[model samples]
Target: MFLTHGMNESGELVSVADVKSGHTNLHCPFCSEKLIARKGAIKEHHFAHAGETCMESKSTIQQTGLPFYDIATGIGKSDIKLLDKFQRYDNVWLSQKQAETAMYLTQGGLLEPSPNKPEKYQLTRLGRDLVKHHDSLLQKKIILPEATLQEQLFPARLAMLQYHDEMNGTQAARFYQLRLQALLNQHLYVLKIHLQQGSTCFPLIKVGITSRSELALRISEIKRDLQQHGEVLSIEIAGLYRHFGSLERLIHKRFRASQFVIGSHTEYFHAIETAHDLSLLNLEALGKRTVEGAYCRTTYREHAHKVRVGQRKAKLLNNTHLGRPAKNAENLLTDHPDIVEAFHASLSLRKANTKTGKAINTVRKVYAALKESGNT
Candidate 1:
């Protein structure tokens, strides 16, 4: 992401690049955490938190106006209702897994857990205070969309779909197919491409958004257009956003002042220079992958999710690990003498006794380090 705000020598707010070359006390305006100025070849210069997670980061994410915030406020809304509403309104959505993870992170006090009602978690004082503080820092107008009475009372039907239930191969495939179809039918998407030909001058990026139904046709049109001018190097569907027009406008506004604009077409920007800027708008670009890779991963996740549910239900039945950490080398060595003996036999018993002893010690050290996540 392009650095939106940063601090300088005098602790004054400034753009990231405006910081003095030798200045080392720069900090993020949002979190007041130390910021690193990254000017890598592939990515744009930006301010990243020194720590792994930052409250500012969460506050900054655009959530597409999902009602999970309502859920965060202790409202009694089912996961199914939220999912359906998002789909129906074509609002940006948080996957059930993602929402659950967020709730887990704040459960103790940041978020008040409802042990009596698992689905109804509340925001504790800390959570409410943080929300209030963040709101004070960044105020916005909220415009609730108009909906029918059925939509307002849709929570009652939340239990209609068993999407979260465990499934077999066939069930998972069917679910994936239906879910993918529903997703495509519900929202539009933005497809980004690096339009270049070896014979052409320089590569330019094109960002276009279209309904999922029109995605194929849009791609074909783009290909024909590019073929008329130059060859198409590659196309990457950067993100899938429910409000495509709004997202497109935001992206365009972000790169409007970029210095790398194409001479022929103002809409196009230098692919390499403007990549990070483009990426920042594509929130779903996390863990970018080819289309096929994404499909395979989704399928794998379906299978894995089912297996996990089964394991959790029958804890005593899974003997695969024998209740030990599956990858713990020390436990494996202790339980299976043959593996240790094989390592011993590999090092000659007579001529290489000292080397064998060292190997054994090294193995122990390696296993210990693996478990403790430390270097000895």
Candidate 2:
């Protein structure tokens, strides 16, 4: 098989697109042998060993030292789905049909039998790494479309947007484009938290965003908070994301009907009742334009509605003829209440544009008005 990814001198995965067709310095990731880039128009670009093909590259069973690439390279879609389930939930009991896939993951060292329940399986360190590094691994694929790679990287791109007191038209356009990309790339997760209220004990799932680094700290905080009600029986990370605050708000809205409030916390929902809707939890499906898109679309509609309201407010303020016509800069500030609120909250004009869906010109005008008024 042709290698889709090669390792650079720095030991980072390099796709065929990252290099030109020639005797390059890239090495086969599995065998560490020098590789030749083949970017001919006749076939898909990939890496071929300059010398004889190593046994490791020829066989799927051979160790590559990169467990994620080694395990992911051979797995089918169903197998990947099974792995996702393990990553998202704790103590996953496999069906007879799923058992075959589970066995493959277990043999690949991605999963292990649950200590408490042998029938159940849990993600091993390797398995967790596979899911965590999924985006990077997907980018290394020569077969996957560039659009797909961009979609997967949408969150990172959005998170990198720089916030300034004022932004130009181009910056505003880039911000809006990234926000739209974020809507399309929403990745939802179910976090199962075991809670005890009075004499009854049950599991409550919270749909939200959290990174791997913060997950342990979050669980610890939850455990500390529930000390009065009852000890947290268990907590499991069903999924994770980086800087997905917008996605979290959308999820809260989607699952609002199923929300259950415990004391001051309203984020929890009954796990048993929410299980029926869990079929929508497929990571691959969520990343595509599916049910997740519907949720994001609803959010976009809300934003659009707010924008229309702002425009109407601007029109009304302009035509009010209160004593004298309001200054254009002051009118913009009055029109976009969200921008005013953002300013009151000490947010920069660039951030206000992002938060309020206001145009860069509007944000700039409002910001100037605020500056003149000594309110900034």
Candidate 3:
């Protein structure tokens, strides 16, 4: 939740003894100050700053507005948490990324953009109003029908879920569903992709979100974009994993100061609950894109994933500009203990395969050297 920011290990969030001292403590959700001094007291998970140096603060809850905690608990405790209450989709775990997609998909006009930091997002007035009227949004138990294999595909379905959730009313939902229905009706073979006969074969892509109404109105437009690129192999159901409860997640999601809809992954279910938007992103290009003249022909395939793995994390952390690694393993161990712990943890997770294991093991040697430095 709190990273010391600049890290000996890139993509690692190191906790500091004095987060406030580091000037990186996230503001307490209730009071808009980064001053939750740990007084070693109960019932004070985050209380107002009371020290002589503390800034005056108050709880952020409002009768009309929902707090981040309320939204998190609401979805986590709901029947559709992680795995379905009645059990759906192979007891799958909703990663942080999957959770995030649901939250963003359910919002109205997307959240308000901050002038101070436009890229960072927060909730909009319309989004808050939709949250206030939750009773109306939950009045549906229907998953619209699909006609083709592409429609039945996972990622496309997830995108459609995001699309349908944005529809404000029943008429809107029906209208959006029809767009998909029409997509299948108009195109023969549903979708087609021919392997180009060439030596170099590389692909590139672009991804964006739109409302069902927009999807419906721009059906021809979407087709045109895909056509210009190459074969539209998918436009299929990719992130079906988290589409079920997206509306609930969207209305309750909170990112940045008070924004929603940060995760780009199709199945960012866990990301929604904790609001962790850390993602793997390309170093050169910030968004999803392919060069105009890629290696050969490029096919546009869209899959909805809840989280962006691997590179997305590196890209997000790169923005923080954490300083370089320690001069030596000995230097690192002596200077940064928290970072060493993170390296060890990252290695231990069964999540690491052989390749990542090697990188992690190398990280540990640095930790050992740091320890050796400390002992000496």
Where does model 1 exceed 4 Å of error? 1-201, 228-233, 236-245, 259-267, 278-282, 285-376
**What is the lDDT ranking, best to worst?**
2, 1, 3
Each model's RMSD to truth, in Å?
Answer: 21.4, 25.3, 28.2
Candidate 2, residue 315: Cα displacement in angstroms equals 59
lDDT of each: 0.42, 0.57, 0.30
Error of 2 at 184 (Å): 12
Cα lDDT of model 3 by residue, 1-376, tens digit: 1111122123222222223332344443223344433423222122233233212111112111111212332222231232221122323344576445444433323243445665434444433333333334452222111111112222223333445445432132232233222221221111111211244222212222222322333335445544553443434221211111112222223222333221222211223323222222111111121212101111222222213343456659774333344276656565555555554565442233343443554555665674576632
Model 1: per-residue Cα lDDT over 344-371, one tens digit each: 4553333233544445544554444444
TM-score of 3: 0.17
Write down the worst ten-residue block by lDDT for model 3: 184-193
TM-score of 1: 0.30
Ranking by TM-score: 1, 2, 3
Candidate 2 residue runs with Cα over 4 Å from true position = 1-189, 211-214, 242-245, 287-376
Minimum summed lDDT over a 10-residue window in model 1 is located at 141-150
Between candidates 1 and 3, which one is better according to lDDT? 1
RMSD of 1: 21.4
Error of 2 at 282 (Å): 2.5
lDDT of 2 at 99: 81
